[model samples]
Target: MAEVVEISDPGDPRLADYRDLRDVELRKHLEAEHGLFLAEGAKVVRRAVEAGHDARSFLMAPRWLDGLADVLERSDGPCFVLSEEMIEQVTGFHVHRGALASLRRQQLPPVDDVLAGARSVLVLEDIVDHTNVGAIFRSGAALGFDAVLLAPRCADPLYRRSIKVGMGAVFSTPWTRLPDWYDALPELSRRGFTTVALTLSEDSVPIEEAVAGVGRLALVLGSEGHGLSPRWEASADRRAIIPMAAGIDSLNVAAATAVACYAAARR
Candidate 1:
């Protein structure tokens, strides 16, 4: 069972894991160094624990205790109870859900492991936005994509903002980064999955036609500003584009993923 400890000082060393969450680079380095990630809100916190992540500690206002009582009771870690103001001071932002948890990150499974038995998967190429990564995971999970694959440069799906935006979908989805970005698509092809690259290339066909009759498929999406690299575009078995009205050439990566996943699910 967890022990509840009341803390008034924002700078207490015990609260170090919960500090300066708004500082992206600092938080990235800190979290990576400690092999931990933060889960915000009661729901995401509970999801993280339920997904088998061990909690290092929990920080919350007194009022949030009851709502998360079951979680705290199940956890053997310490729970720091603080005033809302103190939490805001430590975290550098108002914690609207009034709860935050630092959970240990597990070793990511290899790409082959994540791809085992997967029929439909989403491949992300250099998507740097945590929010977009999270949204893509949520959409892929909801639409029945069996797994997700990320390029070496993609954002961390377990990052706090990504996890929050994904509503913990990152925990449920099977994913891992490709070891070799250059051969990612071809490797998937060798594993019996058709590679469909979503882009605006000259040879691109409609999304539905591109994915049709593919028993196993890997739908690849690119970065925010630039789409897929020329090597990836040319290497794909089929290039696909989502038809749009005038003045709208493309959708945001997340929006595009949702649309493509929906189509892939129905195909």
Candidate 2:
């Protein structure tokens, strides 16, 4: 049985970890120690607990706790019960789900290790929006990308908003950041990976043609407004695109990522 600590006074020091309405630094600390991030809502918390990560503690409403009794019993950590108002006061925001748990984030496999036996990988450069990051991850997980390579400027996929938008797909997908965006290209090439850039260049080939000749492949999608950087575009063995009949300028990065990821995986 998990210990249920009732928290009435918002000033209680035990609740310090959950304080603040929005503190990115505090969340980042969770990543430093165990790579943990808050999994909001009873459902996401339950899934995280079931996945066997060290669930440090849960700040939950009494009513919500009852529904999670089975999972709570299985948790090896403390459960703090708080009133709706107290939770909001501590978190500094309206927590709609009435329940949130802090779980350890596991270390991802190295880029080299991930690429060793991979058939397809998606490389995202300078994608900053958490929503788009989460959506891309959801699509990537469903579309069958072996792994995702995030550049230095990409949003943290494990952030609460991203995780929620991603529907917990971020938990299963493997991602590692490349220290230097350009430095990693040669490494990919050495592993027999054909780097394909999704761009709107005249010399770029159609999606079908590009995939036909490649074995191990890496598809690169740029940031939302800027698209791929000129240097990154030049890094590709060739460029590719999804044909549009109506002269659409381009797809949203999230939608484009899904199309590109699925196409690469299907090949």
Candidate 3:
């Protein structure tokens, strides 16, 4: 069983793992330096542990302890119990759901390993927003996509906000970053996945038609502001667009992924 240590000092060195979480750049640096990521809220914390991630440590208010008793029993890391006020002071924001765990980040599987036996996949390019990445992961998991492939520059899907927003779907989904972005689409084609990029080029076809009858499918999405790059738009096996009602031309990238993944699943 995990040892429970009661702490009152917000500046305690033991609380370093839970500090300044609202500062994105600082959290990124610290989490990468420590090779760890955080799981927030009771459900996300439970899911992280259940998915086989090892806890570096846990921070929670006294009220949240009993609810996570089963998780604590399985974890070897110490649980730092604190008042909700002190928890907010240490973490830099109010943790309403009350439980947080800093979990060791495991090595990423190679691209081929993530794609093995994957009939449907999501390919993301330069999506800088953590929320969109999280939402996309959730959509992919809910709709039964096999895996996710991120371009080298995409946002970290394992970030705390991403994990919370995705409701821990990243843990369940197999994903890895592409080593080479320039030839990514061609490589997917070589691996037997028809690369269908969601774009609005003049010749782009409907998403439903683009994915229809394809044996293996890779649904590609791009960034929020600019959409797909010219090179990527042209390199894909096919370009597709969700036909919109008269005024609106497109959806947000996250919303677009859900629709596209839904379409791909039906194929």
Candidate 4:
């Protein structure tokens, strides 16, 4: 069971993991240095723990305790009970979800291990928005994709914003960063997957046709601002586009991912 420690000081060194969450750069450094990631809300926190992550500590208001009592009972870390105002002051944002947990991060698995038996996969290249990454994971998980592969420059899927937006879908999804961004699609092809990239290239076909009858499919999405790079677009086995209304050329990366995942799920 977790030890309940009521803290009155917002500046306590023991609360380092819960500090300055609004500062993305600072949080990134602190989390990386400590080999940890945060899970926001009772649901995400519970999912992280259920996914076999080790809890470093927990922070919550007195009102949130009963709602997360089972989680506290299962965690061996300290639970710092504080006022709502103190939590906001410490974290630099109102923790609307009423609870937060810090969990130890595991070493990332290799691409081969993540793709061992995947029949349908989502491949992301330089999509750095935490919300988009989280939304993509949620869509892929909900739509039955086998795995996800990220480019080296993609945003951290384990970031607190991502986890919260995805409602902890990252915990259930199998994902890892590709070591070689330039050769990623080619490598997937070598492993017997048909690399279907979402792009606006003139030669691109409809998404349904591109994904149809594929034995093992990898759906590739690109950065929000530029879409797929010329190198990546040309290297894909097939290019596909989601036919949109006459005026709109494309959807937001996350919206596009959900639509694409839906089509791929039935393939």
lDDT (C-alpha, whole model) for all candidates: 0.93, 0.81, 0.94, 0.93
Model 3 clash tally, residue pairs: 0
Pairs of residues at least 3 apart in sequence or in different chains that clash in candidate 2: 35-105, 36-105
Error of 3 at 219 (Å): 0.2
Give the per-residue lDDT of model 1 (tens digit) for 1-267.
789999988999999999899999999999999999999999999999999899999999999999899999999999999999999999999999999999999998998899889999999998999999999999999999999998999999999999999999999989888989998899989999999999998999989999998999999999998989999999999999999887976899899889999999989
Model 2 alpha-carbon drift over 4 Å, by segment: 21-35, 245-247
Q: Cα lDDT for residue 83, model 2?
A: 95
Q: Tens-digit lDDT track for model 3 on 1-267?
A: 789999979999999999999999999999999999999999999999999999989999999999999999999999999999999999999998999999999999999899989999999998999999999999999998989999999999999999888999999999999999999999999989999999999989999999999999999999999999998999999999998998975799999999998888888
Error of 2 at 236 (Å): 1.4
Q: What's the TM-score of each model vs. the native?
A: 0.98, 0.87, 0.98, 0.98
Give candidate 4 misplaced runs (Cα > 4 Å).
none
Q: After superposition, how far is residue 163 of candidate 3 from its true place, in Å?
A: 0.6
TM-score of candidate 4 versus the correct structure, residues matched by position: 0.98
Model 3 score (lDDT): 0.94
lDDT tens digits, residue span 1-267, model 4: 999999999998889999999899999999999999999998899999999898999999998899888988999999999999999999999999879999999988988888989999999999989999999999999999989999989999999999999999899988998989899999999999999999999999989999999999999999999998898999999999999999875899999989998988877
Q: Give residue 171's lDDT in candidate 1 (0 to 100).
A: 91
Better of 1 and 2 by lDDT: 1
Off by over 4 Å in 3: none
